[model samples]
Target: MKTKILTMTIYKKLTTKIHFFKMKIGINNNNAGIIIFLSVFFVSFNTALSVTKDSITYVKPNEYHGLLLNDTSNSIEKYEIQRLNYSTLYDILNTRNELFGMSLGLNGHYNNFLSYGAIDNNIELGINGRSLTNYYNGKYNLENYSPEFFERIEILKGSDAAVLSGHPNNTFLNFQEIIYNTKIPFTRLWYAQEGGSFISADAIFSQNFSKGWNFTFGFKKMDDRLAFDNMSTDYWNLRFILRYNIDSTSSLSISDNFTNNKTITSGGSDPEQSLNMYNPINSSPYYGKIQMRNFRHDLNVTYSKKMNFFNITNTTYLTSDINERALPRFDESDTLGNTSNTETQIGNRINLDFTFDNIEFKAGSNINTFNSEGTNFFTEYSGVNWNLYSRAELKFTKSTSISGGINYGDDSKNGFIGFGERLEHRLNENSSIYLDHSFISKNGLIYSNDLENEKTNLFIAGLNLETIKIEGYYRIVNSPIFNRLVNEFYTEQYNISDYQAFGGSASYREQVLTDLFDKNDKIDLRLQTRINVIVGNDELKNYYPLFTFNAGLNYMLMINKSELNIGFKAGLLDSKTAPRFIPISNSYITTTNNVGIQTTGLNIYSIMKLGNAFVKIEWENLLNANYYNVAYYPERGQIVKLSVVWSFFD
Candidate 1:
């Protein structure tokens, strides 16, 4: 099969310059950590003596804009700063930096990070208003687009069957599009290089036209090597967005995203080599090949109107995706047996919202249709699924509220019903408590013939006390299915069983040492800590971690014209069953024993404003810990990135 490849001439030249720049800045391989620490301390110490600002100003909140799912009509400001910080690409460096109590694990690629114990199968990917969850025989690769392409990302921890018409156990990741609105044209160019042979470049252009019309376009390219061998990957992506406002209360938006990614599958390292944490070797003598090309388009129309007694809003969206992948064996020969898959999907959703007094109601319907054709015992299949849902929220008093919803869907082979309810009570101005429960039955995917429908029951309770929060949940699944290695070559086959899990997490955050300093103190200190524990049945325990702990401290200094932010973070993951690579499938299957890993790192970032231009420098993993989120795939060591943004009005 033919695959797309981006030119490497520019990338090679840029990396050479970046290496020289690193050396000129005194950031060599050795002593980089010490230099970063001293630099942060020195700047902070000097700035503390000449305080010019009152307090640290954190990143602005990405408000909970209304979604098409339900009509919860939340106060836009209610969720502002609910967490210590927002989720950004910086958080990808350390799981401890996650503010949503999520555990993120990465494979070799930056876009292949797994969330909540889910490999690629159990999690759903959404961009703008499109869903790329369906897969034929290949992996659902989310690494096609860069983080810079999205304005903000929102993670919904648990399942919301009524709102999200997909599998019940999957977590929801929503990537919001970057809306362009500038008086004058805006353009940006960015380049970054890491320790390894990893280089990336991006360009963005945006303009606003007359009568509330806007257009934005972006292009990105990346070339990265995963191991010491020739196991490398190249990716390219293009995105375009256009928006037109019919009036103040109505608008239409359209987006198109295209991506091409090629990766070399070397089967990772052997068991013995992986066991040695410090110096692992890729023992696989065979190198396979895999490539994916995806194109997605989304169109959304939204309108809102006010009535005498209530306000009504409607949102309708149409999304389509075409995906293709080719996988060949490790012998560098496609003649023996090569596999390929081509899938096309189209989905649409329409939602209506009505708000009156202290009650809000929502109704929505969705339909998804997909077809797949492939080789290697891959039969042609086509299917259409539809769902209908309704939900309502009522506030009895200022301090108490209740919400519930139900959804019904049919996937041709089976019917699914899901329902959920939640009740919340305010203990004080800074504290609240909530209880929630959900029961859902989900139909298997069209491609999985042997896997039967599954049902799950979940119960959760949580308390939020200002800077301290605690949450717990219990889940039980009937007829669950998971992939297991079937042979020494790491070929995976699906297995069906029942599973149960119980987990809880506690997090605390608070500022310290304020009283010891003067009234005009220039230094500020904040501490954050979190602990997560999960226990599963024997079958399920073999695939997920048992315990995770993270702690970090942040310091801010008020400089004369700029502010400095520095932080140190550390995380520990208790031993559990680890995964081994399956080259043919380009996936990982669980192994028997457990492998404990620890990660520690320091991050220093500074944001400076010079008239209309803003500059930021971020250094991640200064300690350069040698660790692996997966068994054999080693994570990136240390990285340095610099970004600048300039805005001007004509």
Candidate 2:
């Protein structure tokens, strides 16, 4: 209780400081106060104003009134399906591995630009494909960064019988979950101030000639130190969006965002050492001026109509270019491989959704093309890849939905691979099941010789329940794919086909006190668990188990005109097996025998509100537990940050 009180007092004092400064800076406006507060809490300026509450708390997926999703479903008799939206930095850091393909299921990665439709804290994530150890030489950051720029973030699980055409699938791919992040423009001008000295400004203008046609543009810039060690970033984002409603049932929309960013690392380099000194910080010389560039563009359109028997909707997405850094393993080390890489991805998705009473259907197709080129030691390897797939789902009733889909594509330089058919069935609201089969073949092109194709079979089942705000779920999955010599990057032709995997996960959350102190204030507690296993050829163990557990306590408090909130979360994970690099290769290899539950660490955050302003503070690795996010590298220890914000309202 003493700790909680102290945290609250600090936050309240900080909030007062923020408000006082805003007024002293010649920004004497109530709305200005709100804007300042929101910017600090949400860590964004892209979304200027929110008529409704931006969020109940300061970070992504913030919780309000003991509810995760903004809205609830009333059709369900027993459980109110609630979607989780707020997640912390730990949720991003604790995910054990990547989900492999597509963006579904429970993956743990940071959603830098927080989008919606995610479960667990690990759900909304952006992953880096390239290695982190060699960033200095400029291998180009191959990471998918998710930033938060939405007014509200919401996640929907289950079959989504109310929305999409068909019943949702029980499997990751079959699941029709949608994350919606809404953005609303402020009637007043847009503006902001960032960095230590409060440097700020805003830009917004628009013109319209026709009733349905309009054009608008906006630009905002903020330079701030996100952390210590001179780790400051300059962010300049520009956006242009146009929308035209053609009649009533069809509409065309186009938008583009250009973000220019500059980041500076303050750490210096090291003296030369033997091969044993593989650590980048210890062996390589570091100078300032390390930089990165990114460019992304997307286009989409939609059409919908209500018919007598069935409602119809058509949507399409075309993303052209998303390009990032190109460089070597390290600038200071000549022994390290020097390489440059750039990739271009073009993709298209089209879906047709229709409904008949309680039964619904969704049919869609997707195509993607990728091209990559390398320089230096990797210069000889340049390739193009393509993938095409078609999917469909049928909903027989509210409680029962089934789906089937097929995928076909060619790697061109590699070979042809295809998925025959997949099916899913929902037994009831709390449980469901699924089955899948696929065919794969690979060719020797960039790194190795010719390899034979293999077949795969997969199965899964799920169960979920929510009682009195308590939520929990369990899942089992069986997957089989062609097993290869993971240690060998370039191999003389060899075949080892037969890899399998099984995984399970569960979670729980309960409100310990609503109106514990105030009618609008409350306290909550939560717990989560996960497990995974894999089997088949190779060393490392025929069986391994991965588990993760998380717990947290949250409270919302109010004193007079001020409102205060605080929360703490801690997690433990045991991966059983750690990754080992194959000598002379860039890939990581691991065995199935690895098993054990090791403690990772803990994280905590606190928030306080005073008048219209708020303060937020966070500390990571509370116990100073040393753990590796990667095989040899130890993650940072004991980090704390304090920020204050005020929102402006008319």
Candidate 3:
């Protein structure tokens, strides 16, 4: 089987049922530690051969389900936070970038990064157990807000994300809110800049106004330019919360999360990579000129109660999102046209936890009512969806445990039921082995009630050792949905296959440098590698990169009232297919088997800290290697960014 990117040359404008996805709700709140959902998104252009005459109309994957069943990236700790100032979510994720079939691409844009070779937006985003996913295009563009806006940013990756809702093919990124208990008002402020241009500012306040009552607020803003021509982004986020403690075990909280953003793009690098033959290059036309403005707001009210034997939580939320787009009609003049879309999601979630001797159980339900009113390019759509799920974990011995559960969901015209199980056996304090299996179903941007639901059978196995960890997975899909990622490109295609993917990852950690200097805790190092092979049908055979690798090393020293830290890291991707972005539609297109060369990029970066306050100076694409992960629309070049945080807490 030969995997290839298929693209269409002729750019077309066709308005149809928009791709929409439900939100993922992670109810455990703070304990919802970071998760890495590994997924591969395959885009179709139109042919198994070279791209036809540098086209525009292309592909999309409709919230494809991804992988990373039981693996999680490194957790963000206070120490790491001190080493790496909390800025954008992309900044935080850079600490552990893409892993195993994951692609972090389309830089210099909004919150859109990290994709599995699929088309469209493949990741879903949420906050405090509520979804931030948009119904218009089934994406939670990772733009605007900074990770500092939340107390914890949990990455819900892969099948493990079943506890939440979204396209099964999507990894859910949920930001957990900060809950304060200080009687005296406290505040924290942060600011950062690069190349003398202000890039970020943040403010947070917390206070306990009265007994059993607490309030919190947070704000963040940023404006900056990237290496791309006619490319820039401005954004801000605001959050407010009020909580009342009914008693030690019960409380009620209300919150509002609002975000707004604007981005200007020049489309992407010409798939042909040709220098403008016209004189006065500056006067030449911009083949792609696109601008997007959007905003999101969520209002939530939550109540929680704790008992000796059980814990319960119920939350009702309303989320509204609006998007405005201006782009050319694919005409010679590239004159711009305007389109807008809006969505509102009203949802309620009830979750419970119970504890018994050697056993733990959980059950939950979610109800969502969604409505979308379209504009120039979209059609109207409205629907209701609900989900019910339950699970139990039993510890048979100190070294052995088993867990399994099932989920059921339905809407007016479609429904699905799935189940998953896991078993773990501890070999020793430093080692263990486990197995995971699940029979699941995923729905992409649904348009017709008569369309058949997609189903998947997934299997995974892994082992954990004191200094090394490894995992592997196998998956099969029936009737997978794929789309061309070009601007205004839409297609309803079902491609079925068996045993589509098989892959694994390995990780290693040590303190080699520190031990050499008799400072065991002063230096830390890590190395990891992953590989994925797509042995799917002819259409998706060899399109995905075959391998990925990453490494990092850091050193720390402390002095009186001051500290120092320095580190360097690198990531690499190798493959023959490249992914490109289209600014107007916020979508991606592939060379579509049009790649004339095998493209590879090795990006090296450095980080440093001085004083007690954390500051970061990074050399992105330090090697300046030609690569696609950096995106192709605006043309990628080496960039050095310096950002620092000024805080009152110090």
In candidate 3, what residue range of length 10 has the lowest lDDT sum?
A: 13-22
Best by lDDT: 3
Residue pairs clashing, model 1: none
Higher lDDT: candidate 2 or 3? Answer: 3
Q: For candidate 1, lDDT tens digit of each residue in 1-650? A: 01111123333443465557566433334322332333233223323322332232222212222233332311112123121221224343233222222211222243344433333344455653335565453344556655556655555434353345444433445556665554355555454445455545556666565556767777666666644454566666778877665444444566666766556544544556444433435244233444444554444443444444443434445545555445555555645354455566666655566778888887777677777675454457778877787878889998898888887887666777878888889888778898877777765545556666666677777787877777777777776555665544334445456666666667777776442333422333334433333344454464555666666665554445444445555656666565555544445666665666566455555545554445556676688776555556555556665544433331
Please give the distance, in angstroms, between residue 567's alpha carbon in candidate 1 and its true position after superposition.
Answer: 2.6
Task: Name the better of 1 and 2 by lDDT.
Answer: 1
Q: Which parts of model 3 have CA positions greater than 4 angstroms off?
A: 1-80, 94-123, 155-159, 166-171, 195-198, 245-248, 276-287, 329-336, 427-431, 448-450, 485-499, 515-521, 582-590, 593-612, 630-636
Candidate 1, residue 222: how far the Cα is off, in Å: 2.2
lDDT of 2 by residue, 21-99 (tens): 5554333333344444433433222232343344322111111111121123321111111111112222322231222
lDDT of each: 0.53, 0.36, 0.56
| Least accurate 10 contiguous residues by lDDT in model 2 | 126-135
lDDT string, candidate 3, 228-341, tens digits:
455666676788888776666777878887888877766545444446311124323235556778788888887777777787777789988888877756766654477777
RMSD of every candidate to native, in Å, equals 9.4, 11.2, 16.2
Task: Report how far off residue 307 is in candidate 1 (Å).
Answer: 6.7
lDDT of 3 at 109: 62
